[model samples]
Target: MPDFTATTPHIIPLVYQPDSAHWFALVRHLPHAVWLDSGRPQSTYGRFDIIAAAPQCLVETRGANTSIRYDDGRTDESALDPFYLLKKYLPADQLPEHSNSNLPFIGGALGYFAYDLGRRLETMPNLARNDIALPDMSVGIYPWAIIQDHQHKTACLVINTELGQRLGDAYNFLEIEQLCASAAKNPAFHEAINCIKSVQKSFKISEFESNLKVEEYQQALAKIHDYIRAGDCYQVNFAQRFSAEFSGDPLIAYLALRQALPSPFSGFMQLEAGSVLSLSPERFIQVRDKRVETKPIKGTIKRGATPEEDAANAEWLQNSLKNRAENVMIVDLLRNDLSKHCAQVRVPTLCELQTFANVHHLVSTVTGELTPNATALDLLRDAFPGGSITGAPKIRAMEIIEELEPTRRSLYCGSLGYISADGQMDTSIAIRTLVCDGDKIHCWGGGGIVADSETEQEYRESIAKVKVLMDTLEKEFGS
Candidate 1:
């Protein structure tokens, strides 16, 4: 075990007055940058948004290879589990007490854990093709972060000065201090930051392609229904991948997506191979003070054109027996997952109506207290991926997903957020997420198919979920 020095972070207030998107614009150019957005000034689901760039250390896992890259030109290789490597940097007992309890994340690991990483945790048949090869996990250990508390309408540059001092990186520490000072003391610093201006859309105007045709998608749904009837599983989430030739700054597309469809758990991450723009509305899990909560979005219905229609749609989603059953199925699954590392597990909210920019969903909240000996990592490990997206009888549903979905799910249905050094963790299910791999950008949409699920309705539901994203990108970036 390595020794990590404990140090309370210093908070420097910022008067530049920037929202999560604007503050992120200032540091977006930095490598390995991440923005855990709260969809502030618009949505009411989230309160705190954390932004960090140029990590002091990066822990990325690809297949069985895990590498730790440090800022000072140091690289260490390990074959240990990615969770194990991440846990090393997050020592619960050694973390300094957070100076401000309002901030959810000060300094910690911020990144994405791809859904495919589940293969590493549980033994499953390798039936799915490994078509897209990306890091299963990519997280950076940030020494400093800009945390915005939307509830208080306050923002601060919080730095772990002790970690910097312990590393003897005086130059880096001084650079951060100077950066904070400049932002506070100089109004001109705003201009000094390279803000991305509106640019012409760069995506090809050609129609987006899907891995499964409408008929094929329906056929896949039929298979899931058969499985359910055969007593193989109760529900299985099936998704279709849509991709287009994209050639412009994905940041532009991300900016467009956020504006069009703001979500509580939305995030944007710059990775080595590409970038991730997630407008996810589902929260996979959150841990604070050893308390765990998982919000699963199981049922969804498109927003109606009129206010009356919207209200009626919300009412329908709330009362629909099918939707409520789907929500409960996942809630029960999550309760079971949390029980692996938690005590006094309970579902506080079940089948609650939550409306987003495009659709209304039934979301359930499952919470528990971590056992005395269990850590946040342990809780996450037992609940890899998420039950809502995976469906009931998680492992079996995953197997069915592998059999049905044509292409591999790279980042879709994964999680993107932060695990703080002080043992606080918050992550979102990477639903409504996009992946920019080289010249092609991929997007996925899916819904759970149950025994009584309608193939036609499920097909439309899948397309409806991501239609906004596809339309937004094509309209903005399509050449």
Candidate 2:
């Protein structure tokens, strides 16, 4: 890694959503910069939801025509290079050799970058044309070394651990007082609200059912059970499908859905012209300082409307023997997966039931120390498509999925996040997600299938998971 000491003074704070037209322009032109898009959908009401892109590399005390020509051809190449562009600006040697499961990044310390930059921006904030809150979505950037997959119409962004650290640190360092006060006065804030109003009426739900025979699905589940019984696999995450046809721009629909229901792992990714709106709540995997962690969510139960009823439902979910068993089975599966990539593997946490506003879930945390030569990419490849999504004996589960599922998953279970120059990476299990290919839009939802799993219950769970997407659209655009 080259020494970044000389360039430290040049680093400054940048706060802009990446999806906005202007912010996109800034990223296209800025050099040695970090671009982030939190995939939060645009809202027609309340605090203007934002899609911002900030040019961190161009912040300086004196203004120099900080603009560069955007080569449309370059966008294809630029989006693919996960590490090539960021490597130029980051100190490679300063990065750690091992990964960290606890901290954000495992390679170098980009957390400091976010920390220093966020603090500086606080002192000298950049003026924006719009008043939009950064989308409260998962944060990561694509590396600039990889080539855009024009065939798949997807781009890869690399995020270094240093950048991850920087973001985490900066998030903690934010001056909430100043931000809140500034938000009150921004005129664009009101404009953002109006935009939400204009589009709110356009939201609608489109529904569809699978062509696969119900008996076939049942047989598939039975096969999965047979595999478990034979010790071929301990647990397998089996899924079924339901899809819908959409008429408007898929990207636009995704944005509206996000505003209606923002999830912790929400993502908005532009894969060529097609985009994905994901509101997943599961963390697939995270690497920091040579340690790895995965939180697998297995069991789920829908929430009730009343507070008391919701609490009762959560309690019931927590006490349910079947839910607990499903959760543990996945936990064991994840432990074995981690064991392949790391040493000292252990399930420090197990079968912890967590309740979200919409549903209650059974979650467990597994951890391990990374082996030497383990890169963030290597971790993802070894554990591509998390265990919770894929049942135990992942390979067989996937094969069964291909046969049972009617359409390509596309970004349904695929990840969207940045891998930094320092090798820090975080990705979500693409659940509660919508994939838009032009006017056609499809969203997916399913749950783990175990030996004792009931067909009707599983069917309901799948629909329950996607209710937010359904309701958001109907409420916003009308049925």
Give the Å shift of residue 206 in candidate 1: 4.5
Q: Deviation in angstroms for 313 in model 2? A: 2.1
The clash number for model 2 is 60
lDDT string, candidate 1, 1-479, tens digits: 45553456778887535457767866777888898987877778888888889898889888888999888887899998889888778764522333235568768789999999898898777777777667888999888998888877788888886555443354265666576666656655565423454354343534578999888887888888889989999999999999887776777778778888989999999887788999999899998866789999988999999999999989988889998898888888998999998889998888988889999998888998878757677788789999889988999999999998887898899899887766778889999999988777888999988878888888889999999999987776667
User: Clash totals for all models, in order?
Assistant: 1, 60
Q: C-alpha displacement of 196 in model 1, angstroms? A: 1.3
Over 4 Å off in model 2, which ranges? 1-10, 14-186, 201-205, 208-223, 226-232, 249-252
Would you estimate the TM-scores of all the predictions?
0.94, 0.65
Task: Highest lDDT: give the candidate number.
Answer: 1
Q: Where is model 1 more than 4 Å wrong at Cα?
A: 16-18, 92-100, 165-171, 184-195, 200-206
Residue-level lDDT of model 2, residues 1-479, one tens digit each, is 24331111112122333233223322322222221233333321111112222222211111211121122211212222222334434433433664332223212211101111111112322331111111112122321221122223232222232442332223211332233234436666435534544654444556555534668666766776777677666556655455555554343465566555555556554433344666666777776666778888888989888989888988888888888887887787778878887888888877777665478888788888777756555666556667787676666666556555544454566564444445565666777876555545666777777777777777678778887786666555444
Q: Candidate 2 at residue 282, lDDT?
A: 74
Q: List the residue pairs that clash in candidate 1.
A: 203-477
